[model samples]
Target: MVSEPSDAAVPGATVARLPYYLRALRDLAAQGVTTTSSSELAERSGVSSAQLRKDLSYLGSFGTRGVGYDVESLASYITVALGLETEHRLAIVGIGNLGHALANYSGYEARGFQVAALLDASPEVVGTRVAGHVVEHVDDLAAVISRDDVSMVVLATPAHVAQDVADRVVGAGVREILNFAPLALQVPDDVVVRSVDVGGELQILAFHAAARAAAL
Candidate 1:
């Protein structure tokens, strides 16, 4: 059984690693594994055993010294800690290629998030249907967000319009945003924005590959 989440402040780095640990735990559960050690989980999560243990420590004590951590219990605990205990409705803005693909993704619901609305600035695209959601006009962003009770937003618009869309999203009272646009967004201190620059990530990968090739 999952215990109540601790009120202690978890560091940002630890918070980031929590999802990885949760994923690893779930994989174990899927394989019919009921228990795991810090070392084993860390290897699966691509982190060190000591680091995994320290990160989980912020969530309060878990696991047994000899038998290791209960897979189901630890997964449940991490789920609560990561705020996945409740579903979060999302509004995906910009029905461009990337936005459309994101709206069609099947994984969100399993992870406790629902893509409740899809928005786009283009009139041609606005009334179209994608992923079972009829795209709404961007001008109706606030209304759609309010109507759907969306708690999070995914900004898939181009760089130039990302900030404008982000501002409107925040104005509508959503606190969490996932930005796939290429630029950094300026949001209020209370608002959290996670940017995914796919091109930038590819560039980083290319740099690593080049470095390896040079060394060889």
Candidate 2:
């Protein structure tokens, strides 16, 4: 990660959504729009205006009274606040279909996260290169992680393997994990895990929808 500016520790939730705000601002700028009101930004981000304003406030003084904010300026502020102005090294494990997609994907790079290495347990997939990083055997995770000095790890392994991979990653000195598997992991309190389980989220939405329908 970039030299974290003293002002970079936005709330966890705010840090999570600053990229969305930055992207929306860029889209507006691309459309030839120069400025926007908080309400407009709120619409773009699917957040309430108050929340949007508060999040922006955490970054810095971004808006002007009555005039709102300049799209490009706001985008720049959000990017800097999220520590995306500099590059971060990331390690990817589980070279299956999902892992391959992440390795090939350019979104993380655009946000200043560089995929420094890829690892998998299967011998067949080892020695392969995806997104310019040669795939190494999972057994090499510790050496690769330490060698690359990566702080973030992406776990795209199967659910059963997620915790194991995460454990190794923690032991190897990784501080943050982005897990795509559908299982909870055991990690030190200092290590942060962000789980992205599509099925679980879908099920939660279904439950809420059913409750809303019943209320209606």
C-alpha local distance difference test of each model = 0.92, 0.86
Model 2 scores what on Cα lDDT?
0.86
TM-score of each: 0.95, 0.87
Model 2 segments more than 4 A misplaced: 1-9, 209-216
* Tens digit of per-residue lDDT, candidate 1, span 1-216: 334456889999999999899999999999999999889999999999999988888888887888899999999888988899999999999899998789989999888999999999898998899999999999999999999999999999989999999999999999999999999999999999898999999999999999999999
| 175 Cα displacement, candidate 2 (Å) | 0.6
Report the alpha-carbon TM-score of model 1 versus the true structure: 0.95
Q: List the residue pairs that clash in candidate 1.
A: none
Off by more than 4 A, model 1: 1-7
- Highest TM-score model number: 1
The local lDDT score (0 to 100) that residue 173 gets in candidate 1 is 94
lDDT of candidate 2 over 52-162, digit per residue (tens): 978876766667788888888777777777777888899999999999999999788667888999999988899977888889998989999999988799999998888
Model 1: lDDT equals 0.92
